[model samples]
Structures are given as C-alpha cells and as structure tokens.
Target chain A: MNNELLAVRSVSKAFGGVQANQEISLTIPSGKIIGLIGPNGSGKTTLFNSIVGYHPVDQGSVRFQGKEITKMLVPQIARLGLLRTFQQTRIFSGLSCIGNMQISAPVVRSGLKSLFTKFPIDDMEDIEDILAFVGLHSKRHLLAGQLSFGQQKLLEFAMALIAEPKLLLLDEPTAGINPTLINGLIDRLRVANQELGITLFIIEHNMRVIMNIADHIYCLAHGQLLAEGPPDKIQNNQTVIDAYLGAN
Target chain B: MRAWHYLIILLLAVSAPFILPDYRTQLAFLWLMVILALSWDIMGGQMGYNSFGNIIFFGIGMYVCAVFQRDSGLEYFQGLLLGMGLGGLAAVIIALIIGNALLGMRGHYFAIGTLGLSVVAGELAGGWDYIGAGSGLTPPLYPGEISERNVFFYFLFFVWAGITFVSLWWVYRGRFGLAINAIRDNEDKAEAMGIYTTRYKVSAWTLSALFLGVIGGGVGNLIGFIDPKDVAFSGATFGVWMILMAILGGKGSLWGPVIGAIIFHVTQELFWTLFLGWQRVALGLLIVLIVVFFPEGILGWLRQRYPHRMRDANNSTEKNKLNK
Candidate 1:
C-alpha cells in the first residue's frame, strides 16, 4: 500500500482480432524492483510498450505520480521520470558512446541561442558516472557500433541510466549477454534500485536473473497473468511451473 | 574548430572578392551551392529523413519572385523577400502534408515520396502562367550593373555565411539538434527517451525549407530571369547537388557541406569549361565512386585518417577517436 509510482489500471490493447494485452492491472511502488516474466508473445513487451506510450492502450488508464498520462506523448512520459529500454539493445551507432549519452540529455532552450551556446552544466558529470557504473567509462570515446554485443547492452543500460528516471522499465536486459555480463548487469540494477532509490519494472525471461534480482515477480502466459508473488512463491507455484517451466 | 575559427573564416570570406579576380562571380555561385547543401543537410543528412524534394522550396521561391517582379513591379530585393516568404509558407504547408504522410515511411519509400512531391510541384509550376508556364519571366535590371554585381555578390556571401553558420550552429548546440540526431540514430529509442520524433522531423523540414527559400530567392535575383523549367529542373539538380555535397563532405559534420559545396562546385565549373558535355558522365562517375568507397564522404574519410584533429575539444575532453 506504499504510494504507487506507476499505476496501470485495467489496460487492454488489441490489433486486428488479436488481443496483445487484455485487462492488465499493475502497480509499481517507489524504489522497488518488480519483474515481468513471460514466454515469447505473452504480451510482456506489448504491455511495457503501452505503459511507456509506445503503443496506446485501447482501454483503462496509466497514472504516474498522480497525473493521468494516457494522452501524453512518449517524451512527455519520459520527462515525467518514466523511461523504458528496448529488448534489442539500441544505441546511436554513428555517435561515440559519450555522444550517445550526451544527446539523450534534455535540452533547455529553443531557437538561435540553443544552437550557439553549449550548456555544460546539466548532465556531463552524470554521463560519466553512469558510464563508470556500467563499466563503460574506459570505452566512453569509442563509437557505440564498435562495442561488442555485451558492451552494447551495457551502453544501452548507461544511456537509460543517464536520464535519472524515477521509474525505469528495462526490457530483457540479459537477452543476449554472456553469463558474466548478466551478473554485472544484475549487480548494476541492484545498485540502481538500492543505492540510487530508482524504481524498476523489468521484463526479463532469464529465470536466474529474475530470481536473483526481482523483489516481486509477475508471470504471464499467452497474454494473461498466470501467476504473481514474491520470487520464492512464484518459483514454487504450480501454475507458473505448468505454464512456463513445464513447457521448457 | 571553436567559434573563433568560424569568425576568422567568415572574415576571410568577406575580404576575398576585393582581392580575387573576375572569378569572384564563380565563387559567388559556389557559395550559393554551399548554402543550399548546408540547408539540405539539416533535414536530409542530420535528421536522416532522406528527402529528395528539396527543390520544391527553391522552385517555389523562383516562381514567386518571378510573379512578384512581373505583376507587381516590386524592387529586386523586395521581390526576393516576397519570394522567400511565399516559398517558406509553401514549404510549411507541403512539409506538413507530405512530411506527415511520408516521414513515417523508411528508406526508399521516403525518398520516393519526396521525389514525387518535387515532381508534382514541377508539374504545377509548368501549368501556371502567373509565374510562367515553361517560358519563364525576366526581372528588369537594377541600375549600376557593375557595382550592383559586386554588391549583390558580397550580399550573397554574407547571406551564405549567415545561413550556413546558423544551420550548423542550430544542429550543433540546440535541443532540436539533439532530438534530430536521436531520431536519426534510433527513432523508437528516441521516443522512449521523451523526444517527440514527429515534431522534430517536421520542424527540421520547415527550417530546411526556410533556408532553401532564401537561397532560391538569392539565385533568382542573381540570374535576373526565371523560367518554370529553370525553377523545376535546375531546382531539382540543386537538391541532388546538395545531397551530393552533404555526402561528399560528411553528412553529420557541420563544416562538411560547406567544404563539399566548395569542392564540388569548383570541380563542376572546371569540368564544364574543359570537358563540356562529358561533365555529367564524369560527375556521375565521381559520385558513384565516392558513395561506394567513402560512404561517410570526405570529412568522414578525413575523420577516419586524422580522428583527433576533428574532435570538438570544448564539448567533451574524453573524445572517442573514430576508427577508419
């Protein structure tokens, strides 16, 4: 019953006879690590997309910090301190790693002045800090495309972190990373939540990552929530086993 | 280079016509190309919108100037301003209509949509007599022809400098530049980060059009006569030339288009004087070779070879060197 940082109430979305998400209700309280787990096509991504305004929900409402943001644009939601990352790591390939981070920082001015003057005060230090946090400070000057797959994943993480969002939605952070990198990413997420007090709603399929990092877990099967509990109970639940683990 | 570097370059440019020979007129044309290329770079290159209809604004400016001069007997400078205003208005309207429809399309489709719009604009101009069907119109000569030429050349040089500097500055320092670059890099990621991709894209189109309009007016006044074929066909060539210059110079680099324009136009003039009809084939070959071998263009190639030399030192000390 702690104040919910993000409230998704009875949200539903559909596309041409296919219901991607239906009647999904979830609340993420401030400073908690919540996991969203599901098989492929279980509407985990669709739901995340809806919350972040990537895809409009056909029904229900999304309220962040007591503001009804259903009609807001994606950037507006992000400015309100809610941010999401793609499942496939997306970084500016042409830009250096630091350049990618710098461009994502918000702009303060419009017109001629904004073009001529470089406001150095805002997020330069934060970019360095995030790069160091993600172990990418050493590679800060490298073109993002030059990074290895694991490093690209880290860069994406760093980019998301630079925004300093109140709510961070990570989509499959460990999808293609090696086991060592997975541990590193999970450790960073822990630090982000515990040390920085950033709320996290992560969509992950890796059971080890979910079990190790998630405070609470929601499991979906074929676009419906099959189980929800703390990691321990969710791991032991028969419905989760039959729907997810049994098939695997 | 720092801001001082730009100031020095502008000063040198302003002083050039005084010392340079009759070739200043040719240099003025080169400056025009640079302005057009830089304007095109804003929307097509930096924003990755891939528009091929850039000539639409230029043509609109030409036609409007023609109409204003012929029908209203407006002064040459006044006609240019009127033309620019009309062109900008047309660009805003067309950009909203076409940009909204085609901005969502990726790659070739987007290019084709812009090309289609250019063609439609060309056809519309060809059918309108107010500007001139296909025959075109001529502006009465302003008195003091020699002094006027020098004045006009210098005027264009300053305008060129102003437009190029402003365009580059806008792309480099502002939120709009950041947003445009984000969209170019990854649209979905940019949106998720709270950048409005559509609005930024359309705005880029509008800004680019404004510059194109101004340049078009300048060119129309410089020539003293305008025709639909000149407006449409030459305008289209201007669009293509802008893209070529942008790609050749370094699409994302602020100084790239300027350098590209100078090199491209100078070479073009050289070829036209020497090879005449074969210049087109040679130019085509050059473009193909550049696109194939040096995808990032000359500045890109230079950056690869001398990475540290191109680094913007004041922006970030931890500048990552781009590998060839």
Candidate 2:
C-alpha cells in the first residue's frame, strides 16, 4: 500500500499553443508539508487548479488515494477529501466567519431535507473549534468582508480546515499578508499538518516562509519542474536560484 | 421567536377575510404579489443569480390554467394544479439548460440570457392562437353573484397563505436555503467546499418556477379573464416589482420581500386610485428614492436599527449593524 495521498503523473495542459504545464509529476504523502515555488507564469497556480479539478489536464492522470480523479468536477474532487484555496483569499464576503466555515462543513446530502430543515447537528461545536484554532473565535460573527485581508486569509484557512480535508492545496497562503500575520498563519499551517496530520501542498513565492515550513520543495520554471529536493538542497540548486532569485 | 412570528402571521391570515373590506379583493392580489416576490427572492436574492426570465414561469402558470379551463372546463383549483405542473415541467427543462449556461457566466451575461428568454417566451405566447394568441383565455367566474366575490376572496387568501407558509418553511429551515446562500455568497469557494453550485441553482429555479406557476394560475382564476397583454405585461411588471421588493425588503431575509410586496402593493393601490394616471410615475420615483436612500429596503433598515435581533450571520447582519 503506497502511503501517497495524491499523485500527479506526467500531466500536461496547453491553452491554444501555450503549454501551461509540461509533463509535471509529483507525489504528496499523507503527512507531509510540500512547498511548490516558481517564478511568475511557471504554472504553479495552474498545477494547483489541475489538482483541484479547476483546469482539465490535456494529457495525464491525477490519482487521489489510488483512484483516478482526473475527470472529476471541482466539487466532486473536493467532496472526496482533496481541497484547494485560491491565490486570492476566497472567503465568502457576505457570510460571517463561522457561516463561511459552516458552508464548507460536510453534511450528508439529504436533498429536500437539507434545503428545508435547519438541523443543529454537532456542527456548531466544530465551527467554534475551527474558529478558535484560527484565532478567529472572537470575530466569528463578523462579516468576512469586514475582516482585514490578513484576517480573511486566516478565515479562508479556517474554512478549509473545517472540511477536515485529507489533502490541502494552499495557493500563496503568505502572499499579500503582513510579516506578523504570516508567521501566525505559518504556525497554524504547521499545527494543521503536525497535529491534525493533514497533508499540505503549498505554493508560495516567499522563500523564507517556504524554507521554514516545507518538509520538501518543488521548484518550477516555465511549466517544467526545475528542481525537487529538501529545502536546503533546493536553496543551493542552480536552477531555482537562477529562475527565482535572478528575477528578484 | 420563529414560532411566535409564524403564529402571528397565521392568526392574521385566518382573520384577514373577515376584518378587511370586500372591495379590497385587491389585497388578495397583493398576496399573490407577495408569493411571486418570495419566489423571486429564493432564486435571485438567496442564490445570487439575477433572473429576468422569471416572468416566463408566471406566464406559463397563467396560460396553462387559462387554456385548461377554456378547453376542458376544468374547475379553478384543477386548472391551478395543472398550471403548477406545467410550470414545474417547464422550469425543470429551462433551469437545466439556462441554469447550466448561466451558472458559468458571471454578472451581466447571466442577466442578458434571462432577458432574452423572457422576450422569446412572450413572443411565442403572442403568436400562439389556440392559447389565445394576442387575446388570452378567461376562466369562468365564481359560480355565484357579485355579492359572493368575498367568498372567492377568502379562497385566494388561504391559497396565498399556504404558499407563503410553505416558501417560508422551505427557505428558512431547509438544506436548499443553505446551499443557495452558500452559492450566492461565493460560488467558486462554495464549489471548492463541495457544493454542486450548478445543480443547486437549477433546483432553485425549478422550485421558484413551481410556486410562481401556481400563483399565476390562481391569479388567472381570481380575475376570470386572461389576455396576452395581461399575462405579458403583468408578468414583466411583477418580475421587476419582485426585484424591487427583494432589494427594498433586503434580499435573503425570508420575510423581507413579503413585507416589501405588501407595503409596495398597498401604497401603489392607494396612490393609483387617488393619483390616477400619475400613479406609475409616482411608483417609479418611489423606486428610485428607495434604491438611492434606503438601498437595503425597509426590512434592512429595521434590521440595521436592531442588529442583535437579526443576527443570522448570512445576510443583513452587517447592513443592519451599520444602519444603527
């Protein structure tokens, strides 16, 4: 039994003549934090989209726990315990912090019963717990739109965590966030991975954040995997340094 | 709180026909408007998808009942049931096609698609002669004298009450409401959180259409006359009015649009009777004023004034708190 939770095998995607992803293959283990870093237009978000079923792979296979899910819709893939966040925080602006979490909470499909009944299952406690974990318990009633950008990012994390996903794909979790909040978010991510044992595949431009938390790293440039190794090894790799640091 | 609220509404509904004047049969008309507004709110307000073609369901309801009575001599209630079935069937098809296409199109395009559908439906109705073409079929009057109009009025009241209660029950307590609200707030996020947004949107359309259809049939039977102009114009006006009420009452709050429909219809009736030809202009101006100053609507204003009382965390919580 392979302990791999997700495997993207030789996946290729092209838009018109532009190849967005080129034969990218990666395996995410059940309890690991893997960092994905790349220069702009390196297909980091594209790969994330493909894994979460936002974008269809032109030629490849995506397996989740040994089942091929390449053709699954985004919601179907999400229901199967693989979830992804957007590059921009996708918190429900109209919903409260807790309401956002509740929307993502897993409930059995009860058709009309789900539509017409407000059953108070143990979900309320689950919402409160997730809020506390994300340090948003105090702001549970606040509209998500009213939260600061950093707070919204935290809310987004809490929303994802409420689903108790087996594999979490986080796109630029630290991007546009202040350094102070970034550290707190990183801590939460660490806790989510370590304590909850949720596998995290993150895309981040912040090398410091990535190197600090990632158990392993994959670097991409121009839709191709440039390097893959432990953080120290990736830090010294010529391709990663040249592709990422050269531009900066 | 919810139980008490419904109890009060039920008491009022049960006593309305006795306390209110007979000439105010128009009040039943207003109740019909409330049902229509609530139906629109479920799809547009709660689901966050603006549908201009909602009138099609209303028109289908009206025509189905009208044609059934004219061709088969079906009783008013039987015609109403047929209309509802037709509306649901039409809605399931339209929702599957339009809902799927519109779900992927954001904002303006979605609105335009519905607008196009409404136009096409109206044109089709106008061209069909067996269904009365430009002229509409009329139902047989209540099988009694003019003095018995109040009896029919009471019947309409119960029908309206039943619909309003059912809609409120489903929308406030059901999983459908949760799914629809989730889709409304952030569709992409909802999808990524395991919501089938397209399916829910289509289901909302189907449900809303079913209600609108039955109400349309009831309204047709109430008037005992149907014409293309009445069906098309009234349907279109009600569609617009539904949006206004949803905005005025605050969308996503189940009772908001109902209150809006009542207030708006009552005010319009008073104004139209008193001001005559100037009534429409006055109503138009009022809509503008309401949108400009109190964009959240009356319920929204009330909620704002008393935030703690209406803290559902889904909608109006922020607006209500801000108003205070």
Candidate 3:
C-alpha cells in the first residue's frame, strides 16, 4: 500500500446502458512504467478517465498518493500531481507552444491568487529546456495550430512535462506521430521515468513501443482484465496473445 | 498599437468634448459602448463563454442605484456613489449565484441559456412596481447646468472606460489571461491541465458584471430614465449590441473589441439620422458586411493582411526597451 502510487479498486463505469469498464482493479507502484493495451473499444481510455476523475465511477474508488480521489473533479485530481494527455492531441492550437507550456506551469504550485499575478517569467529557461527536450524548441514561437500533427503531439507531451506531474497518464502518445519521432519519444519517456523519477501509465496500441519501455503490462478485453505480467511474459501469455496479440 | 498611439488616442478622447461641445452626449454614449464591448469580450472573446445575458447585471445595477438613491435620502453625489457601489456588489453576487449553474453549459447552450436570462430579467423588472414597472423610473436630475451635466457624465464614462481598459490590460498579461485563453482553446484539456474551468469562468463573468453593473448605474443616471424593458434591460438592443460590437472588432484579441466599439458606435451614430426610416436597414447591411468580409473582426482582417507588421511592432518595442 505504501509503495503504490495509484490504486483503482473494482472501478466500474457505464455510459447509459454501455458498460465501458466493469469491476476493473489495478495498482501502479511508484517509479514504474505501467502499460495498458487492448483492442479497439476495450475500455482502455475509459479506465484512464476513471482513474483521473474525468467522470465519476459508477461503483468503486480510486486512490492517488494514499488519498481517495474518486469523488474529486478533474482539476482537483490534477492538482494532486496526477495528469493525463488525451488520445487525440489536446494542445492549445491558437496559442504558441510556449504559451501552452506557460499555462500548464502555474497549476503545479499555486492557488486562485495566482490568477492575478504576472506570468511566471522565471520559468522561461525551464520551458525552453523542456521544449528542447521534446525537440519542439524551433517551433516554440509558432501557433500550435501551424504545427504538423506529430509536432502537436510533442507539444501536448511537453505541456504535461511542464506541469512536473507525479504520475503521467498518456493515452496513445504515438498514435499519429511520425515513425522516426517514436523512438525519440520513447527515450524521453524513459528519461522522465528514470531520471526525473516520474511514474508513467501509458495506454498504447503500438506493441513495439510499449514492450520496449513498459516494465509491466496489463491486457484488457471486453472491459475486463485479461492478463498482467512483465512485458515478455505478457507478450508470450497464450490468453493475451490470442485475445490481443492476435496469435500471429 | 503602441504606447504613443495610445497616448494620442487618450489626448483625442480627453479633448473631444472640449473641441466638439455640441456632441458631448453622443461622445458620452461612445464611451459607454466602449465599456459594453470591452466587458463583453472578457467572456465572449477571451474566456470563450459567449454570454448574452450580461445586461441583466447592468439592469440590476441601474435599479439598485436608482432605488437606493430614492429611498436613502442621502446627498445627490453621495447617494449616486454609494448606489453604484451597491449595484456593482449586487451584480457580482448574482453572477456568483447563477454562474455555477449557467456557466456549466458549453458553447451554444451557454449562449442560449444566457439569452433566456436577460429576457426573464426584463419581464421581472417590467412587472415590478417597486422599480416603477413599465412606466419607468426617472433618476434625480443633474444639479448643474444642462451643458455641465453632459460634461460630467462624459468624464464619468471616460474615467470608467479608461479603468476597464487598463485593468483588462494588466490582468491579461497574467495567469488569469492564460487560464481563460486555455479554456477558449479547449475546455476539457484545460481542466485536465489543472485549470479550474468553472471557477475561472465564474470569475471572468463576475468581472464583466462588476464593470457592467457599475456602468449601468452611471448610464441610468446619464439617460435620466430607466424603462424596465427598453432602457434598463433592453436585451434586443444593448445586449445584442454588446456581442455585435465585440465580434465586429474581433473576439479574442485585446484591442479587437475596443477598436470594434469605436467603429461600431461612430458608424451607428453617424448614420442613424442620415438613413432616417432606413436606419435599421443600414444597420442590417452593416452587420451582413461585417460577417461576410470581416468575420474575424477588423483587427483580425488587419492582422491577416499585415501579420508581420504587428509582429515587427512588438519586436521593435522589445528591442527598444532592451537598448534603453
């Protein structure tokens, strides 16, 4: 319990009559990369949403950092140092890359009074560093809408990084990204997990990327947990192979 | 666009009444339009919560101030000042109460919800006899000369508009601006990024209401009458004009609504009498032209045409400051 960073117990969510996630339970221990993979419509995104308080769980509770966050709102859960990126990139398209980073920066340390205070110009170097880290340094001044879709995904990742969250939930970080940038993103994810000591919970359809980075993997099918184990074991597990890896 | 340009505009505004003493009331109304457009942009443009019922606060302020003045029996200026303060407070309180419910709505739903709010306020005020019902309430007459009254009201509006402009400028350079702009860009992601979207939305609306409410009191006193429908809560006119003027200038940028208001008011006032019976037609044509040619507003048009010019202006200012 003390080592666990997040614990979701018997969580269930329904969209009217559709049971997206049913009796799902999972634990992410500190400083580990956890992967959640499933075929399309297997409730992968719904579970991420449930854990981060995007919507209320129909039954069960979520605990982050030893505190129950099931009843909290998105921003409240976010303020506790757990943040998530969208499956479709969610960068502020009208703002410059730096502007997106600046907006995400203040949320980590301040309260309502910060609203009237000046932009934290003090974070300029930090923002530049993170943008450079994500290879978005050259596009920092351009409106995010002008960026290629891959760059927009990187901008969204950089935004989550700027918040310096304790645990980052990434939904398909490489979904629309350029193939060449995928390896670079994987390296950065490892650095964030190992060097910066940020835990990661990623939902990926890209088996190669997840297998390369995730320490442990969970397989979900038909809204229920199918398998959980080390990457290699999960890769060879007959159930996961038949259900998700497609027996090829 | 620069500090000197602003200074020149300030000089012109300050000297306008003195130079064109005949048009003092029209000039006062121009400043009122500026206040309306600027306040509306805080929600409609910056925060992306396009509210149509902001005029409710304005009416509340007008009635609150007038009622306080009537019942308090205080000195004229003292009563007016206290009344305006109470009116502003009343608007903020109302915003706080309804903000949670109404602001929870998104996009067109929020717009429609707010539209219903002003109509209801109009009906409620129209039927309330305590505030004079439909016959209207006449505020105490200005104590000074007829011309002096114009100048006094002109300066009152001028001062308030200036405060609105400066306060928005200061706040927009800060976290509040970034937060609201994030909401404008994408609200769901803004919440995930840890912005309290509802709190910021309510605060932004309340801020707009505070300005509108205070100005509403001054407007009531300026016009010297408060018709529950036409004057105080005229949704079809003042409320719609607030949105139209902001969109005319540009919705998102800081100076868009300001410039938009200047053009809108000048055009409306200049052409209102000239067109006579065709004034509404002329106004309709103007709206059509704005939507067709300048959907992004005048500033948006200019920015698109001379994007680098604005960027250069900003760069040069920074370069000059660094040199100094």
Candidate 4:
C-alpha cells in the first residue's frame, strides 16, 4: 500500500440490473506491471474506465499519488499523470501520426489563447522520437486509419506515452493484434514500464501473454476478485482456473 | 508558395471594389457569406458538431446593434462602433452560457439542439417587443448616399472576413487545430489525452460567435433594415446556407469552406439574377446534386484527384517533408 502508485478501494459499479463490478479493490505499485484478467463480461474494462474517471464509481474511492481522484473527470485524472487507452483503439484516425501525438499532450485547456499558439518545436521532435520508438517513424505522416490495426495499436500506445504518464491503464492492447506482432507489443509494453519507469496496469484475456509479462495477476469472476497473485501462482491457482473456465 | 496563393486572393479582394464597382455591394455580401461559412466550419467542419444554431449569434448581433444605434443619441460612427462592441459582447456572453449545455450533445443531438436554439432564438426575438418583435428593428439611417453607405459597409465586412480567414488559418496550423480534428475523429480519446473537450468546444463556439455577432451588426447596417425572420433570424436561409456551404466545400479542410462559400454564393447570386422566381428551386436541386455526388465537397474531390499539392491538403506538405 505504501509503494502503491494507484489505489482502488471497494469500488463498485453497476449498469442497470447487472452488477459489472462489485466492490473491487486493487493496488498497482509504482513502476511494476499489474494485470487484470477476466471473462468477457467480468468487468475488466469497467474497472479500467472507473479508475481512469471515464465513469464515476457508485461506491468507494480511487487515489493516485496519494490524492483522491474519484470525483475527477478523465482529463483531470489524465492531467495528474494518470492515463488509459480504450479496448477499441481510440486513435484519431484522420490525423497524421505526428498530429495524433501532438494533440495527445493536452495543450488546449488554456482557453481561447491556445488557438493562437503554435506547438513548440521541442514537442514536435519529441513526438517524432516517440514515434520512432514505437517503430512508426516511417509512418510519421501516415494517417492512423491508413495504418494496419496492429500499427494503429502502436500509434495509440505512442499517443498515450507522449504525455509521459506516470501510470498507464491499457484495456485489451493485444486483443486484435496478430500473433507475430504480439511479441513486439509486449516488448514495447515492458520497455515502457522498465525503461520509461511508467507503472502499467493492464486488462488482458490472453493468459500466455499476461503470464509472460505481468509480475502480479488479478482474476475477476462474476464481478468479484476471484484470485490475485504472482503470474505463476495465479496460473496454477485452482480458483483462478475455475473462474476462467466456468465464467461462460 | 502559400504566400503567393494568399497574395493573389488578397489582391483580388482589395481590388474588387474598384474593378467591379457595380458589384461592390454584392461582393460585400459574398465576403460576409465567406465569414459565415468559414466560421461555421470551425465547429461544423473541423470539429464535426454540425451546429444549426450559429444564426442565433448573427441575429443577436443584428438586433443588439440595431437597438443600440436606433436608441443611442450618439454620433453616427460612434453609435455604430458602440453597438458593434456591445453586440459582439452579448454574443460572447450568450455563447458562454449556452455552449456548455448544447455542446455536450454529440452528433445529431448537438445538431438538433443547436437547431432548436436557433429557432427558439427566432421565436424569442419575435415575441420580445423591445427588440422590435416580429417587425424587426432598424439600424440608424445611413447619413451618406446609398452607394457611399454600401462602400463603407463593404469595407467593414471585407475587413471582418479578412480577419476571420487569417486568424482561422493560423488556428488551423497549430495545436488547437489538431485538437479540434482529434475531437472530430474521436472526442473520447481527445478527452482521455487530457485535452478538456468542453473547453475546446466552447472556445471554438465563442470564437465563432464573436465573429458572427460583429458581422451581424455589419449586415444590419449594410441592409439598413432588419425583419425577424427574413433578415435577422432567417434560419431557413442563412443558417442552412452556412452548413450547406461548409459541406459543399468539404467540411474538415480549411480552404474547403472558403472555396465552398465563394462558389455557393456565386451560384446563388446567379440564380437570383438569372432565374429570378425559380432561384430557390434551382438552389435546392444544386444542393441535392452536391450532396448526392460530391458529398466530400469540391475541395475534397480535388484532394482526391490530385493527391499531390493543395494548400489545405491537411498534411500533404508535412507528409512530404517527413518523407524527405
């Protein structure tokens, strides 16, 4: 708890008659990989959304860097160095990769005066460097929509990282990525965590991928935390196995 | 290269008064339409909000200036300046209040909400006797000859159009433009990236309102008359025209709406002059044809065909530089 960069406590959220998340609690220690795995409707995405302030939680609170952010909106939460990506890969498809990167830094909140200001050249070059890091350097001017789905995911990752987020929440980053590119995405994620020192809290369904990367794993079942432990322990845990196989 | 292009347009705009003196008044109206279309594009084109309520600011500008000038005991130009100032302020204040509630609605909901606001404004203006109700108030009578009045208003509208164009051009080249395009492409992502979407949306609308309000005041002085529906709150005409012109020009690109406004105004003018009684019908058919065939707009079509150099080709030049 003391080393935690993000703390989610007793957070419960329900949509209409269904309870998507029922009093879920988790902590992501700074600069470590934390995995959230659940069945399709087990509320992995919901938890990510709630934590990022995409939606307000019905109960409980969220703390980032020891400050309460439960009532903050996505932009406010994101400004405090907490960021998240979507399951559907929400890059601005129409903008060039650099444009996407440039806009992702949240420089428009200063009111009307911002309209008159040009982006700093340093930010532009920094975006280029990040694009290169993500292996989209050659496609810097390419529209995100024109890139392959896997490439779009990479661009989305770069967009998220462009802000130098202290912590990143990723929802199904490898969902539609091809097997060949999965290794590449995983490597990028690890590098983003270890080299960049960004705390990663990810929701994934691919067991092999999660097991290979996440230091700690969480398994949610029926809107509750079924099990959480080190990847190897969680992999062999009987309750975790049951939660995955029986959730259908 | 871009400077030369702008230079040619600048020369043409500056010389139009002398070169086509007979058409100065009409040219002024054309510039006014350019301001309307280009400003509308800031929201409807770049941001994809498709607001139909933009005319609300225009009507307010018209009435506020008209009322101030009519009621003010000040000198002619003084009253005019004072009215324009107050009218623009009123528009900014109104936009600030309404932008939050209305801009929250996405896509068609935003469209309908703005449309409702425009119509409600028209209805409210009609009911409010202070601003002349259904009859519409008039600006202070022009002290100069009709031609002199037209020239003065022409310069005013022309200068306003120039300011709107240059400012929007600068805006489109910067981070604000990218943020706007991001909102158009995916607003949720824009927000999640830390760009406060509401602030951007409201600011864009406020900028649009500021121009519309000022130009509305100019329009009141240009015509020297205002009727609630026909002149001031003519949503069925001016309101729809702004959206159609932007769409016809291609919504997202900066020059699309500008080019769209020029061509649309010319066509509409020709119809009014040549076809007379059949103008609206002809305009309707033309719009249908544009919507059906070139929905991406004239600029969009050109961009597709050329794929090379277009000033407003989004990132064509930037893409080229990156490739190099």
Q: What order do you get sorting by TM-score, best first?
A: 3, 4, 2, 1
Judged by DockQ cut-offs, is candidate 2 incorrect, acceptable, medium or high? Answer: medium
Give per-residue CA lDDT, model 4, range A62-116, as digits (tens).
9998999999999988889999988988899888888888887655455667766
Query: lDDT per residue, candidate 3, B1-324, as tens digits?
Result: 668998999999999999999999999999999999999999999988889999999999999999999999999889898999999999999999999889889999999899888889988988889989878899887888989999989999999999999998778767788789899999999999888888889999999999999988999999999998898898989999989999999987777888899999999987787988888889989999999999999888887899987665322422342232
Model 2: per-residue lDDT, tens digit, A114-161? 655554558778888889988899998787899998889888888889
Candidate 1 Cα outliers beyond 4 Å, as residue runs: A15-18, A106-117, B1-20, B70-104, B146-151, B232-236, B308-324
What 10-residue stretch in candidate 3 chain A is worst by lDDT?
A106-115
Question: Model 4 clash pairs?
Answer: none
DockQ of 1: 0.49
TM-score, second chain, candidate 3: 0.96
For candidate 2 chain B, which ten residues in a row score worst on lDDT?
A: B313-322
Q: What is the iRMS for every candidate structure?
A: 2.9, 2.0, 1.4, 1.4
Q: List DockQ, one per candidate, in order.
A: 0.49, 0.63, 0.74, 0.79
Task: Give Cα distance to truth, residue A156, candidate 3, Å.
Answer: 1.0
**Model 1: clashing residue pairs?**
A75-B194, A141-B320
Error of 3 at A13 (Å): 1.7
Tens digits of per-residue lDDT, candidate 2, B65-138, equal: 66666676677557556755665566556656666776677666787777776667777888888887876677
Cα distance off (Å), candidate 3, residue A124: 1.4
Give the C-alpha miss distance for residue B47 in model 1, angstroms.
Answer: 1.3
